[model samples]
Target: MNFTPLHRALGLPPCPLTDEILSDAVTSGVTETDDLDWKSELPPIKGLSQTDVPKDIAAMANSGGGMIVYGVEEHGKAATGRSDAGEFTEGHERAYRSVAVTAISPPVFGLEVHRLGTECRAVAVVIPASVDGPHLIYKNDFFGAPIRNDADTAWMKERQIEAMYRARFNERRRATEAVDSLFAEAAEGRDTVERAWLIAVAHPRVPGALTRLTRDEAREVFNDARTITLSFSKNTGIHPLDNVEYLNPRPGLRRWVAPNAATGDRSIWKESWVSVHHDGSVSLATAVGGHRMSSDGYWEGWQVEGRGVECAVADFMALIRAAARSLHLDEYDVRVGVEWSGEQPLSILTVDGSGFPYDGVSTPLRAFTSARSTVTASASDADFHRQTRELAEDCVNQGGITYLHVIEPLPEDEN
Candidate 1:
């Protein structure tokens, strides 16, 4: 439930945007900016397909994303009054999505459409700042990337387009590097014990304005996150924050660390921990496997339980969503990896009677394997589930477990 820039500008509450907020924005003399636009009305469905909806959306995305509010009359880019844009049905919302997809190139992801007011509804289209830009809008015979120029929409020139392409590539590289760095940091000191680690990291492209929190406040917010049951081949009830009992601040990293390191033998890598950063980033690691003892009690290679990986992914995604909400962030780039140290390859042990694994799935590992993807905190439950499953599948598949299905469809009511 990340609030839009417009919400911040208007000094409105961060959630449940309504007509009162819109009216307050107008009365307070709020005007259009590079990230905010106001519209008096919307065209008919046919006209909307060919009108400025796509252009405005593209411009906002290119200009670091913002909101386009309909039913707000404006003069000289200054808010004038609120007018009824008319009722927006589910079909109408779908029409807007369809137009954005068909009319814009490299369609923007994480677009949110909100209906405000009960009697006289106003529509708000929130576009996320995309790493996939520059997004183009096609005219009759030509296509041009639209950019927000001050308070208006403008076409991108040749040099601006080139710079955008460069920026896009750099963003991708940085995201990959960030994931690798975080994984390496978490994996440190693991060599002291024989264990397979599940490490996950969530990094925001444009970092949030999350201020530092006291250790007490940090503990309360994290512990309060809901523990939802993720249904896969089995039901794994996990909440990343709830897994750890002890919490302490790591001021050097500007984060709070919660680890269940064994008190008796600190060298043993039987630990589950989560690190929440001030920049709205989070890193979590949980040990799913330890020394596999033979019948004679001899140590064998690491054997990772397949169900542990599934449960870890479920907990990771849930915690990520909670962190995003707390920091008022929308989009994040996420990475997950499994690491173990040994000459022999790690084994993903299947349940004895589940029939989900075979002998050939376990192969020799060089060191570690990982997968990365992007997620929107405010996305629909189905999309969130799909993204989490895809990331988990990629990580497991790298270890030769191809048939792992980590996320199941949400219940009807939840959908």
Candidate 2:
């Protein structure tokens, strides 16, 4: 997540921590900065409660987050060489995590700990810029917020603490508003469409590096989305950006819009379109209903296919993942919704096991005009797939679907 500014300087990514990168840092003599620290030894397990590991972590978290590399020796604050920190086992990882959880107030989440090297092992902890911060360190009767001061850790001053708290609250509010605003924006012209439209929206708690995108960059993101959609193990029904004739910028909203056709028109879902925003929020609006016409040529609305709804939601999750990676974001508040043309309860057509409509089984299994589900989760969580399935199911369940069978199937071992 670009935990350290040195990542850009050294042409390195802040992930997949490797021995080669460590060695290169030593050769380059990279010095400790506001977002990077080096240590020669692991914290002792015996007196772990009294160690500075928690403080270091809190400092980094309070100051835009960074990495703490244990096993790197330093001279005059510059990385000198790698040291033999001995074997790092699961015990070591848990020990460090425990200290972080217990010693810090409002425990920091989403820490990425990596074990590197073999004979002479090392550990790297990647901490995200927390939205819940101004994290306080309370141990042995000392309670105060710690922040990174360039190459040093220091106690946060009263003014700084106040500011951090304000920023934290403001961020929470903005994130909440952003999620709703993005969803409403995606559903802007939904009323005109005769068929049902599926909408997926995601807003990161801590915004990322995507302040804007050039025309080429916007096209590249679409290409990446196409690649990501294809790579998904689950089938996504909607090809969101497939038919866009232009990639246009909406400077007022600080986002780029790629609409399928009728670009100047206010109506959406004439065809599918996607919007990628500067704050790492993204959304997709696509029509999911096919022809349902009568012999008299009167406009008859069709039922939303259950499989297509599930697939579109699944693909939307994939797009969120891609956007998170591109923007270097982690946690997000995501929402999925289904909207129809009229207030009349719209039916959802269930599919059989063979991926076709069931024969002689009452076709419209569930009915609802609209359904929405929201979740706050980390994109990198191990349980992401399960969570996504649950979210998609929850959205449909409101409409009485009960379950989402078309999304990615869970492992047999998982509950």
Candidate 3:
């Protein structure tokens, strides 16, 4: 296989060679072969003295790169023949790790030792060039010394040591340039945020009716949809209704219940508050005379039709959805539902003319108003009341028109 400059410099294949190919090469006396510059065989010297291994390692690392095949013969012209000789076994792998740790200076970091097939007869030491410096093999006499010349390893001369250091500096400079180029490309918008949403019309348990929306489209839906029913609890926070809660009450009933109730009887009162808080921030408290009044327990001592409550809720949701779509958020993040203030009773509508058939009778919609003082602690009473009154008026005028224009029911296919 073709080898990269880095690989050849390390004295190994570009990629790992199979044990079979390695064994065959060794048996064929390929160890004696020379690359354009250096020999591929282990030096005749037995048990590389702790000092020499580092120098040889450094030279191989610094020189364009070559592999040092251990346990093989370096015959000049022909096969010098094989011997059991200083073979490296599994134990040698561990020993090499130690040798790298103690002997080499500035370290040969990515060194790998591979056993060559069956007899443990051959081994290869792969050492990558150091990006740091001309490695010094700590010898007894010479102290910090480099490999002399590329030929049979000897003590390094002063000039050779300087050249090696220069090469290292150049490698680091090149690496920095490469990194800068990468950063420049990234900054130019090669990478960006990707958003996705899974909008399922039918529940997850059912199949064939799921729809998926991409980021831009979902954002459009969120920004344009009218009347969003978001459930927000200062305690629990806003979230989609859980499946059990979503399924327990019939869609019409669920639509009617306060957005805060999870199941029967339980109310999320203390945990929440609601406000229009838009550019034209408005609120409707129980005192106003419609559905909001009926729900808030402040009726004018007269009964109102349940359809009024349904229509108001549907209208509110339609407005929220439109606002969310205009804001460009995904539908998955938007939800709509009735709100309950635990401060008062929550009511359910009955089929018969009898008012509030549920165990907890509902208050009048008028009692529930747009007044901020009733919903928020920090809001001024007068300001809250004014905002609520304005909001009630807007809901009646602007919100009512917008709802009629957008929320008409779709015609069903009879086929």
Candidate 4:
């Protein structure tokens, strides 16, 4: 999807997405709309207590969010004619953030300001539609919530503001539902019942109102065969669908669906599968059946191939990097949950963690769950390697037996 030509056709303006897109908008002959606005200059930041700039931002976000192009002066409503009003200053990004933090009530997230166009003649502020919005411009002795109205800014009516507050919950629910629906649909018609699966889902705290990538572009992205990493325990057997790798699958969707195949065979379960959404959300999953030893010992009790943690840190980093690149995101603030289920329960006490292809363990160890614990860390900070050590705190009394059981039970009240 080449937006460069589309921008030329519609005459858009500077946007936070890219310089080329903004250039096309500038020449598109598009006039100012309720969600679009142009300014002759960046907001002055000489210790000003408050300015209309923050209100301008509130108006756009309150009206479901849009871009504010500073330094380009519109000629009437049509932008058929315009000029560079001013140049970007060094500390302006900080100032823009300040406005959101200090002047706007309830603040906003993902408010980004970028210098755009040739020779830095323009600046664009991209405000993502927020789930926690109806942002008010709060300055000394005044309380105002702004809304955009047909190329103009206006104050929101009391009822409308109240409605915005009430709608917040529904919007959040819809956003969450949308991501869950994506995961459900991505695995459609697949037989994951007998296999173990790792499913990871992420959504930006602020809404991702991004332009969709073209199928051609997505194909180009998935062309890197390494994008879908494949690893299995030496004992794990794989089905012969090696030739099946990637697919576009449908129209108007620039997504990369990995390990491309139509079969539901458990052999392919050892490999990773990815689903990239147009709205910048991503889901990565791998399904495999591995063997879990029970009290029955090394002879085996519960067996499923391609299960258990193997190369977890490396695999996860690769998946996250690939998702981020495909979705065009530079940072991630997401909630992640892992659900691992298989044809049989892992008989932990009998099986040795050392196994065939050693991913990490050097000795035979069996772990049994006695209590549930929540481990928390930033995506930047935690990994299975690091968190495993922290989780060891609960099993210190296992001693030299190479087994895990709760050493300290949490209080009943805490539980």
- lDDT against the true structure, per candidate, is 0.72, 0.69, 0.35, 0.50
In candidate 3, what are the lDDT values of residues 197-259, reduced to their tens digit?
111010100011122333343333323322132221111111222111211222121121112
Q: How do the candidates rank by TM-score, highest first?
A: 1, 2, 4, 3
In order of appearance, the predictions have TM-scores of: 0.84, 0.73, 0.38, 0.60
Candidate 1 lDDT over 1-415, as tens digits, reads: 4477667987655577666777788887688999989998866776786888888899999999899988888898999888899988777888888877788988876677788887666888888778878999888998999999989899999999999999999988988788788878877776524667788888887787667856875665455433432332245422334456535534436887776644344323346777778887888887766522333342343666565677778777776776776776677888887777666677775443464334455655666657777878666767676766776677666566665544564455246
- Model 4 gets an lDDT of 0.50
* Better structure of 1 and 2 per lDDT: 1
**Residue-level lDDT tens digits of model 2 in 1-415:** 3435556548875555567777788889999988889989988886786888889989999988888888999998899888988777788777887888888887877787778788778888888888788899886677999998889999988999899899988987787788878888898976434777778888887777655766666666666666655543354343445545434533336777776663433323336777778777878887766522233332234466566677676667766776666666677777677766554456666556666543233234334433444333443333666666776776665544655656656676346
Top-TM-score structure, candidate number: 1
Candidate 3: C-alpha lDDT: 0.35
lDDT of 3 at 222: 29
Which order, best to worst by lDDT?
A: 1, 2, 4, 3
Identify the leading candidate in terms of lDDT.
Answer: 1
Q: Which residue segments of model 1 deviate by more than 4 Å?
A: 1-16, 213-226, 229-242, 246-252, 261-270, 291-301, 354-361, 405-415
| Clash count per candidate | 0, 0, 63, 12
